[model samples]
Target chain A: MKSILLATTTFREAVRDRVFGLVAAFGLLLVLSTVIISPLTVGARGKIVTDIGLASISLFSLLMVLFVGSGMVHKEIDRRTIMTILSKPISRLDYLLGKYLGLWATLFVMMAAMTLIFACACALTEAEWKPTYLVALGMALCEMTVVTAVVVFFSSFTTPVLTSLFTLATFIVGHAIGDLERFAMVTGSAGMERAADISRFVLPNLDLFNVRNAVVHDLPVHSEHVVWAVVYALLYSAVLLAISDLLFRRREFK
Target chain B: MMTVLELRSVSKSYRSDFLFRRMPALTDVTFDVAAGETFAYLGHNGAGKTTTIKSLLGLIRVDAGNIRVFGHAPGTMAAKRRLGYLPENPYFYDHLTAREFLHLAARLNDMNRSDAKHRADQLLALVKMDHKANVRLRNFSKGMLQRVGLAQALIGDPELLVLDEPMGGLDPVGRYEVRRILEELKSRGKTLFMSSHILADVETLADRAAILNGGTLRRLVDLHELGHQERIMDLKFTQLSEAMVGELVRRGYPVERRAEAHHVLVEEHFAMAGLIDELVRSGSRLLRAAPHRVSLEEIFLREVERDVGQTPEDLLHRTVDELVGATSVKEESTP
Candidate 1:
């Protein structure tokens, strides 16, 4: 119940933020620009539009998480607002979970708005409306859940600038973990292989959620694969949140 | 009769890595606030007043010792449920309207929707913020923000309030309103643990006050006792001879001479009857005699001054030297 209140408040605050408004406006413009830019693709105009639209939504969501989500805890601590909230009967774990869930709520709104704009652009174009588009978007949202957790995890102990850099690096490395593992298999170096193995285990495989290419290119994406990706994202996010809670628990807000 | 808050030998130090220096913010600080009492945690800046308050609220962990709120460890939810804390320079979500903020606070305390709204409304009215309830806090003045902060602190209907500089950033009227609110809370049997440099407000509101200096507990005073003027007596005399004045001065009474009146300040423990007889014998006409009690401000200053006799510059230099020495020792032992 407390988490819901906190999440509602966070969502309200985020939606009212001028920065969120600006980012959402920019995202819509970029998504709509796909229509104008699709004619220049020379071929596969519909595919290009769908691909760009999906990628634009993903990119904007990442930007939102990186810029706004990373500051969730840092802003509270900097402004000393956490003192009042935490002084209540709320536990630190509840506070952290509330903040994480709040950012996710905010992301959900941003995604819904951007997805609406993307869908409209897709409808206006010659692209076929595939139910797979929603699946791809659902996966994108799941990927953002992981990104939000990563950003919030860094936010628990660091400044927003460092949190952003760290989360962005994590996001990049997370998406490339599969490639790193594959490279490790082909490489003859033992040390490189061990490092790759560690990276694959430690980092979230964000690539598991990247079904935009399959959906865009009209390729098959199994429902079982989607379910596994959802489970993986949730479990990874839970681990990150737990670590964040531990770090936040030990932190002194001096 | 019940202790609402207690701290025993609580200590905390902030360590800076740049110099390897650990600056102790609180040391052996101990005090308690009783139920239905207004206890003022009095100190100047850097006197560990805020540190102690934060320690009580579990915002910062003490390096040593224990703090209990209502007999439960301060970090426990059971204790927090009974306590409300207003931090120094209270900040809120600027995007949230005052009503929204209060509602959120109410809900966080587990109030149902209707109850939360009703309580929020009551608090807003109590704080005289109902008119601006829909206004975002970013538009609030410091005084307004303080009032709203107090309102939220009270929204939980907490049994105890831990306020750090509650009257800070308030105008005279705002301060008076807050004082009234505190007095009302006291009338209803709410315990208050507040830290403030405003000794006048502390004097007006505190039942007991604990003074801290140099990160140590200097003294804890019962205002009821200190409020009694009988401790010190002021005697006024007319037509007092210089010889009598000299004699009184020699006898250790604080004598002050005006153009036509001589005043002798006497401690209650001294023989006032003998002094009066001496004054009559000296053919001096007695004008008036009255008792004067010390103010909280005077006592606070005296306590701080007594802790460090030298000038502030000298004290600062000594502190720096000690920190450097401590840091050097720490670095040497690190290996």
Candidate 2:
């Protein structure tokens, strides 16, 4: 119940920030630019429009999470705002979960708004409307779910600058884990393969959400894959949130 | 009276950034605030007052000892639900308006929507911020922000209020307003545990106070008893002959000459009788004989200065111990 209030507060704050507005407006322009740039590509104009539009959505949403979410918890601690809230009946878990949900809500809004602009750009560029575009955007939102959780995890225990770097590294490592495992397998390097094996349990498989290529190219993606990918995102986020709670519970907000 | 807040030999230490050396923030601090009393937690900068407040509020884990609010552990929801905290120089969400911030705080405390709004409205008016309820906190002045901070702290209307430096960083008018609001809260039987360097305000509002110095509890002062213990008297005289002045000095009273007035310091009330008899025999004109009471500032400074007068060896040993991370067992302070 408190988490919803916190979520609305977080969403309101993000909406009120001029930076959020500026970035959002810029994101809209970037998505619509697919119209101007779709003619530049030699191949299918519709495919180019879809690719650029989807990439814009992914990039802008990740940027918002990195820039804003990294500072979410730490800002409260630094400013001593959490002092009053925590001094109330709110548990550390509730506070953490509230902050987590709040940040995710903000991410959800950013993704939704970008998706809306992407859809409009699709119509403006005469690109065929397909459900895959929605799926591609939804997968990006899932990826953002992981990224949002990662930022909160790091921000719970560290500074904003470090949180951003660590979250970005987590995102990069999560996406490259698959290739890293393949490379280790091809070389038959026991140590590297072992590292990759352990990473599967530790790092998120963000590749599960990378359906932009298959989505834009009209490839087959089973409904089960989408369902399982969302499940994986939720489960992975829960693990990260639980660890974050443990760390946060023991924190001294001095 | 029921004990609303209790700290039993609480201690805390923070590790230094460079050497990871143990820097003690609080040591063997023990005090309890009774119901319907305003207890002042007094300390200078870096004197562990905030550490103690945070310990009581469960914002930080104390290295040793225990703290309870309403008989529940500090961090437990049972304890928290009974207390409200207003930190020094509270920095809330700048983007949030005064009403929005209070609404969130109310909801966090499990208040329903109608109750939250109603409480927000009441608290805003209580803090005299109803006129600026819609103003963003980022645009508020320091004193205005403090007013909002106080209102939010009272959102739950808890049984106890833990205010750290509530009067700090405020102008004279701001201080007056805050003190007035605190007085009203006190009138309603709310227990207040506050820390302030303003001794006048402490003396005005606090029923009792505990002074912390050098990470240790220095003294637990009862203001009522302190005021009663001051027995010195100041006797002012005019038109006293030089011989009378000489005789009075010989009789052991120090006379201070201020323009036309001769002031005599009477050490005790028993001595004042003899001095007055002598003055009457000498036909000295008595202007006024006023009782001299020691101010809290004087007491506070004396206590803090006593702690500052450590021997060179004690200082060197403490520094080395801090550098080497040595644990020294501390005992409870005697009042």
Candidate 3:
């Protein structure tokens, strides 16, 4: 029960963080700007809007995960507040899970709000409001799950700066994972091959969850793909949070 | 009485960045805090006071030994349900109003919507922050933050209260209010285990205290024994003759003659009437007489200084031996 209250508190705290407000405003503006620029893209107005809208969700949501998630534990420790909270009957896992869910909730709200505006702009252009917006939103959520996991994992042992860098690096590699593998094969470098393989496994293939293209082109969406991506996200996030919980369990706040 | 909390042979160390080195923070420390007792865990800066509190709260795991709160492991759900904690230099979500934060805590403690609201109101009033309940925590002073933290800790009405430097940022009035609140809780039979550098506050509030140094429990100062019932008197009289001073000395009063007065030290067992009667009978004018009581700070500092190298268990063993000896003496006399 306390865990539930704690999760709510965590959500509120993350929501009010200055970074959240900044990203929300930025996303709102970026998605809104897509309306003015959509017609300039000639025959690709729908694609442009979808691209801008998806990019806004991806970028702003990642910002929230990286900035807010990395600082969750460190801020508590630095302010000596962890002592007060942890000294209660709450377990480390409860604290970690509560925080993860809290940030996820904030991301959900922010993404949903931005998607509404994105949809409105697309609808204004005689582009039908396809049900595929749900697909894009789902994929966006999956993207954040992986990003939040990476943030939580790095936050356990490293400083916020390092965690941000590592998470951002993972985001980049997760996107270009296919290219890295193909490059490794062509170069015939065993070390590079191993590095690429490890990167592919370690970094989530965010592109797999990139359903924006499917949404834009009006392609038939795969329910199996959604299930696989969701399962992958859940498994990946659980691993990251598990490692985070392990790290937090051993942290001595003095 | 059930032990509200206990740490058995607990040892904790931090791994150093410099390879293979572990800095021991607490070493084989063992103690039990009885239900409703205000046990003070004391130490200087860098002492294991915070470390011990952290371990008991399960903020950090001990390398060896075990700790139980309410008969359950420290980090377990059941154990946490009965606990409330106040950290030193508390920081809350600055954007949230005080009420919001406490409401959040109450909700987490599993209170229903209406119940959480009521508890939040009650706690804020208890902490004397009812007026500031709706104010954002960002604008609060340090004392306000500490008070809010106190309110938050009590959100669940925890059976076991753990306070880490609760008085750190409080002003004199705030400290007094906190002390009053603690006294109220103590009277209601709630256990409080706290660590603080504020020796005077600890002396005034704590029943028994354990001192920590260099990540070790050095000694537990028994407040009752160290508190003497004797009152020493500092006397000043105008032009007191030698005969009057001699009369005081004859009545078994230790007298030290200063520039124009005499100092009389009174032991607890010494009846004051005989000396007062004798002084009046001798016709010596009593200009001034003031009683001085033994302070807990002095005893705390003395024991802390004297037991510098002793482990926490060593001090506990010594106290146990003294108790055994005293009990046996009572038993022998009874026969």
Against the true structure, whose lDDT is highest?
1
Each candidate's chain B TM-score? 0.83, 0.80, 0.73
- Encode model 1's per-residue lDDT on A1-254: one tens digit a residue: 68777888888888878646745675566555664776677877778777777887888889888888878888889888999999988989888888889889988878888777777776787767788899999999999999999988999999999999998898899889888878877886788789888888888888999998888877999989999999999999999999999999999888
User: How well docked is model 2, in DockQ terms?
Assistant: 0.78
Query: In candidate 1, what are the lDDT values of residues B1-335, reduced to their tens digit?
Result: 99888889999999967997999999988887889999998888989888788788788999999888889987789998998888888889989999999999998888999999999999999989999999999899988989999998998999999888999999998899999999999999999989998888998899999999989999998888874733767788998876766666454455655567866666667788888888988899888888756667656766787765675433332333332232221122223
For model 1, fnat equals 0.80
Candidate 3, lDDT over the whole model: 0.77
The DockQ-derived docking category for candidate 1 is medium
lDDT for model 2 comes to 0.83
Clashing pairs in 1: none
lDDT of 2 by residue, A1-254 (tens): 77677778887888888545734675556665665776677768877777777887788788888888888888889889898888988788888888888878877877777777677777777677798788888888999998888988998899999999998898899999999899999999999999999888899989889999998889988899999999999999999999999999998988
lDDT of the candidates, in the order given: 0.83, 0.83, 0.77
Candidates in order, TM-scores: namely: 0.88, 0.88, 0.79
For candidate 2, list the clashing residue pairs, or say none.
none
Rank list by DockQ: 1, 2, 3
DockQ of 3: 0.47
Model 2, docking class? medium
